[model samples]
Target: MAVTKRRTRRSKEEARALILEAAETLLRKGGPAAVTMRAVAGNLGITDAAVSHHFGTRQELLEALLHQGGRRLKDELNAALKEWRETKPSIQSLVDVIADVYADGAYSELALQLHLSGWRDRGSGLLNSVVDELHAMRTKAFAAGGRKRPSIQETRFAVGMMHQTLALDPLFGEDFRRSAGISSADKPSIKQRKEMWGAMLRAILEG
Candidate 1:
């Protein structure tokens, strides 16, 4: 006789998490096109309507994933900054800390997909809200590090540029830069790019 696995009941939160995890996995493996309710439901051994009950639509599910992913990234950045502050605090340290976060391979990969999808389906507001929140977090982090307040416009601009560069790098960074003969020797690795962006941000915000 073959043993059959028992189906255990899950709480609402657990169910939502499972669905999102399935969807995220699909996204990572096959991009947005692969993330459909039916696919996610099948992955979870549930019906499409069951998954729909949690998110109503695929866009809603994607929005939830973006928010969740953004929060995780922000938390990681905050933790890195906090750990650095414990030793010594400075504007340079701030730059180094966040640059490392940008260079973080796993986070960067997932984030690139989520961001591309966000751009693909514009006007979601989820991505924009997260961006605004990240800006606030950076401002607070700067204050905590004893740097003069950064200007709102400059900070936003710096972050926007940084995100665009960081997000697109996986797809177009090497090829585009190589073709253009952009100096490969000092091509501002992720950390260096963040450092430079940070310095520019500091000058604009602290001046």
Candidate 2:
């Protein structure tokens, strides 16, 4: 049975955007569980039914938000690759992009929720687009005849480093910051990130 929602059709886009904005805001202020359709609608001064009309359900809305974030991440990564591939790309540029990709404060906040959501919903596929994009870039790099070519798995893992950089180990934020050194501290900084990328990438390309 095809069920339909009741609401003015004018707010479809606005509703979706508002839902995501609310979700993000919720995650930033509290965490994922704090986000609710009713709360989001209230925040936007809209009705719950209106929000539901655009998202279908709460789960759908969360997944859609992740998917949207993933697509934008992939786009930025692809653009960075395009810039790096021109005229003997440097490891620094690659690392810079990696670091900068998730360095945005907005993404950082949303990413925490996505990770938590992934545990409960393994099939989110929010990052499928980004996963595919990474492979495509690796294939192109190898096909270029003179650049580095990492195994598809290796490419994905290297990209995963961004998440790892954000995760850190054992130390809390303040502790980590206090003990931060060149490589450790640099990994998180956009500037140092490019340097790391360049060095790691150059090694792989030369290998």
Pick by lDDT: which candidate is best?
1
Q: Could you give the C-alpha RMSD of every candidate to the true structure, in order shown? A: 6.0, 7.5
Task: Supply the global lDDT for candidate 1.
Answer: 0.67
**Against the true structure, whose TM-score is highest?**
1
Question: Scored by CA lDDT, what does every candidate get?
Answer: 0.67, 0.60
Query: Taking the tens digit of each residue's C-alpha lDDT, what string does model 1 give over 103-179?
Result: 53434555566666664434333234334544576678788999876566665666566556655565567678788
List residue ranges in candidate 1 displaced over 4 A: 1-6, 89-152, 182-207
Question: What TM-score should be assigned to candidate 2?
Answer: 0.57
lDDT of 2: 0.60
Instruction: List residue ranges in candidate 2 displaced over 4 A.
Output: 1-14, 25-34, 85-88, 104-153, 162-190, 204-207
Q: What tens-digit string does per-residue lDDT give for candidate 2 at 67-172? A: 6666665676667666755655444554555455555444555456666667343544433444465567567767786766557666556556544564332124
